[model samples]
Target chain A: MAKTVDAKHIISITVENKPGVLARISGLFSSRGFNIDSLAVGETEEPTLSRMTIVVKGDEATLEQIRKQLGKIIDVVKVQDFSGLDFVERDLALLKVNAPAAKRGEILQIVEVFRGKIVDVGQRHLMIELSGPEAKIEAMIALMQPYGIKEVARTGRIAMVRGVK
Target chain B: MSKKSKTSKPVERGREPKTGSQILVDALIAEGAQVIFGIPGGALIDVFDALYDAPLRFILTRHEQGAAHAADGYARATGRVGVCMATSGPGATNLVTGIATANFDSVPIVAITGQVPTNLIGNDAFQEADITGICRPITKHSFLVKDVKELARVIKEAFYIASTGRPGPVLVDLPRDVSRAVCEGNPSSEISLRGYKPVYEGNIKQIRLAAKVINDASRPVIYAGGGVIISGASEQLRALAKKAHIPATTTLMALGAFPEDHPLSLGMLGMHGTAYANHAVMESDLIIAIGARFDDRITGKVDAFAPHAKILHIDIDPASISKNIRVDVPVVGDAKNILENLIPLVEPAEHKEWLKTIAKWKKDRPLTYSDTGLKPQYIVEQICEATKGEAIIATEVGQNQMWAAQFFTFTRPRSIITSGGLGTMGYGFPACIGAQVGCPDKIVFDIAGDGSIQMNIQELATAVNNQLPVNVAILNNGYLGMVRQWQELFFKKRYSHTTLTGSPDFSKVAQAYGAEGRLIEKKEDVRPALEEAVASPRTFVLDFHIDPEENVFPMVPAGEALDKMIDGLA
Candidate 1:
């Protein structure tokens, strides 16, 4: 019988760095109807290879299907699903908040609590840079919402096993 | 295995700086291509010029779609990678349906499409289309060769990717400049792709587990698919069934994987399948699915399909397992290798009671049709008798395809070729041409429909030009019969423009193309017409006027369970 385990999943994929690789991978996700909450891709330590971290929501069957489907792509070298593993994930976000001098102290304190850096300061805004797990990043975004955040840019989740092999 | 090994290392040749077109021809010759199906266009003029001096015979098809299907047919018939070519824009786009058809059925074919020059690629030049992008999702892999230096290697890689693993169509997009540029034609002899290794050996533990399940089950059925034929595992599949005393049911794609004449055979299963086969699957306790994906057409209602059975899916593509139906024992590897390993481990035992139940079901509701008028089924049966079930039968989709699948008995692998997944019309005639070209000694027949035959009717010229002697049996119902069947059953018989009132006389059309033609309206004429067509030296088209309203029986309506078949209005 098909297994039914629905939850968030982080899939780490290693693929050869080639033209249209990203398009092919993303096309596969869209074509298969898999829900991708977040996705991050970049060159790995080896220039010839690239790694992708995709955060998706699906049942065990869906995840397994996704993994198998991903593995079928000719350029995909390896697929690692961190579903039940000790893993560390990080998401970096840069938010430009409406920092009128009146609420400057409050925003700075909240940024300090999240260990975020104020990279830029203008007359009306403070650009804050924060990097952490997705939850932490989301929490910070929520705390800064009341301060009228102007623009936000986020690098989607990137993950690795907690321990070295 | 008398054919030269596809993976054999290339022979050393004197190094020569040649144009990319010359390299492409050399690569095809080295890859052991006997023929190419294609049309020439402005973008591919250089390649055509190079092919002029090459040994490969290029069969110029009227349409790019025909070229692709012909190549697919050749591949399916000969167990070799079929090749086709097209130009940019409309020509490349035309091959989409055929390429998708081959892809869905896992037929190994390589489509070479010439593109506008590299500088004009993104500039919206005339007759320019992003073919690689268009075929990306359908093809196993696609390459856009930007440089002449990579042409030979890309061609080699395209062929390798197409024929390996779960074989499917591959596309190579060559820019006009790339084909014209000079390069050292030292094609890569060794193909080493770190990311593209396909596992051939199944896990022994899983095989043993599957064996134990088979041994423990009171009833087991072997569900075979096209992969068995693709992997040439019919012998192994037959042995396993015989040794284990298990009943075998094939999918439409795997019509010839197991001989239908065998007592253990249940014919095809699932939608429009044999009633006995569906009943057996629903009642079986174990299903040994080999080289078959549980497609929705087979599953009917996925949740309730084979509810009482534990499925053991053995396929080369791991994704195919549990993608639709959950598999209990999933073995990922080549089906042939897994079956070879599994045959010995499985214990032999005949469930006398179970077999008796299946036999009763078969007797109770065997495939039945009226012996009146010029029935398409009777024509198919006659064709089978005439060829002794040995003809390479290719079919166009719809009622004609279903009729051929039901009535004709296939006794060997690669004997039946049809568009199963994409369900493309106009596939049969060109496919027959390819099959006849690939296997000249064997008779090839295309069972086509009136609506579908016209789609690629122009290919009669190609067939006559090549003197293929391919036979076409047009089940001329004068309508899109399959759709009309659905309309009759569900849509209040509105017809919905399904009639083909203005269609040309196929016989005269065939004669116009310099081939023999006959119109048979009587049952007595069917056998004689078939005999005459088969004996003809040139290509022959036989238009058999069949019943327009005949519907395929034992059909599981959309979203219904397999067992809940509507067996022809009660």
Candidate 2:
């Protein structure tokens, strides 16, 4: 029943900014075999503190278990499943694909359709830039595969609650 | 809850005023802390007052080091960030080593230290030191909260960073005045940083490229590392291996990624790894490295690791790719995703010649072990079989660790957990707690040595109090076996302080912790004791007093060239 889903669950947890606190939180999730989703950490309004916004995906039970276990972290003050809340999720993708003279126009056309901008064009290659949910970017990249893609780099999903609670 | 008032117990003479500490304690409990592990300090008496009335259970330990380790144990055991508190100066420094150990092992822990009063701070005053600076290198992040208003928010963020990507340890330092200052209700806020974006998904092109590589590889070998275990990709690894017909070998940290007994499975590779395994690497033309970096231990002479093979390294961290060894194709992605894409790329290639070639190497240089007087191999085999090979075996790093890798048949990936990367001596017990927490149905045992067991023996109490069923199998060789062997071979047998002669009775120690403890005096008693230990409802410790002079052979000396191995028994 353990399966890897495509959508990485995002969790926003609040905690005291103290020593060894990070280890405690990560240890909990790691122990449960929940690899962290995209992790973005920074200080909150309090100068002495910080906040960790994480995204990871697992089964319903695992996600709940992860949340419950996170409560045990010594420095953690709160755990929230931001993905389940009203939030905006976005990801960035950069792809390197071959662009022949014959296909250059078609490639540019495809890029514009995906709202992707042409970032670079070297000898016989085109680099496209796009930002959105993971699946949309993936679909765009898949469409460009037949053109003999050279390389693709992506920033995993990062999200925020739509309306700040 | 204890109906204790703040003023019920009078503050100690050297303590600060009660009102300030009460405020600190109230804020801590408001943050939902159930218990804390730490020691008291002279300057933080005000915080203690708050702790008394807040219904928080504080478990005091013998030393700050023990407190931190205890917190680490709790974190690992409960899947939570373990918290430890200590006063400034020596108290904070005492927690440093434990914090570093947790960092190395990737354990989530939160440490709190009480600094000297704000006015008296940084004056070389009594019991003051720059703990933040000293711990900066060891912690994921550190904090110094001068104002009490920031304490709540600081603690909130500490938990967040600790549990996030690639979990590690973090520290929070509070001055005496800060802990006492009154803070408003929970300081709820958002976090925004420019530098902290963790990548979760794999690159689509890289996934396709990995697929293409698998499709083209005539003699491909899959090398898995600890990240596979961390990401829980054993099932996906197996699916990819079976679909692609690629032989799989695991790095030390990824022992359980694929079934050890699989036909396409080659045992561990590297310096001390089986000769057949190393030969397979040299013979293969393609190496698909998954969730593993090319560490020196795995790739003996780096330049020669896979000279003939075109290496495809896929990892979560981009820096890990081509960090140690070179790579032809670098895929920055999760192991499971990459494997999923590769499955479709495998075109049913019944490459008989490649399989036969690898088979020849396996037959010529098969792994071997002997059954001489009181063979530890026999003990390992019996226990593994007795537990149906489903047990999560934890080993103290060294020869026994390698021996366990060599002998034990692991059918399930992630079943055999150990201190692979760090090779820490005291990691066995606490890691077993973590493993047990992860897989409650499996038998979790820490196979320890006489020397390694004593490193963090106090964890026995944690296990006992929590009622976690774990077995401690001590292979009492009376020495730090690995170091002793090195000395025996290179230093003309001038054994240093490695010998553990006339140590404390481990059985009595176990008894003190309210658990079953047995001493295996005779060789025949070993199996029965093992069975009894595994079946016991409580924590069990089996101490086997073994021959002091025995040694584990097949050692590869550090920095002495790959072939300069002193493997007499091999």
> Which model scores highest in lDDT?
1
Best by DockQ: 1
Interface RMSD of 2: 14.1
Residue B373, candidate 1: C-alpha displacement in angstroms: 1.4
Q: Model 1 in CAPRI terms: which quality?
A: medium
Q: What are the candidates' individual DockQ scores?
A: 0.77, 0.02
**Backbone clashes, each candidate:** 0, 39
Tell me the lDDT of model 2 at A80.
Answer: 78
Worst 10 residues of 2 chain B by lDDT: B186-195
What are the runs in model 1 whose C-alpha is more than 4 Å off? A1-5, B1-13, B184-189
Candidate 1 Cα deviation (angstroms), residue A114: 1.7
lDDT of 2 by residue, B229-332 (tens): 65667898888878767888887767877888898888787766766666667777889898887777888766556667888888866656665676788877
Give the per-residue lDDT of model 1 (tens digit) for B123-154.
99999998988888999999999988788778
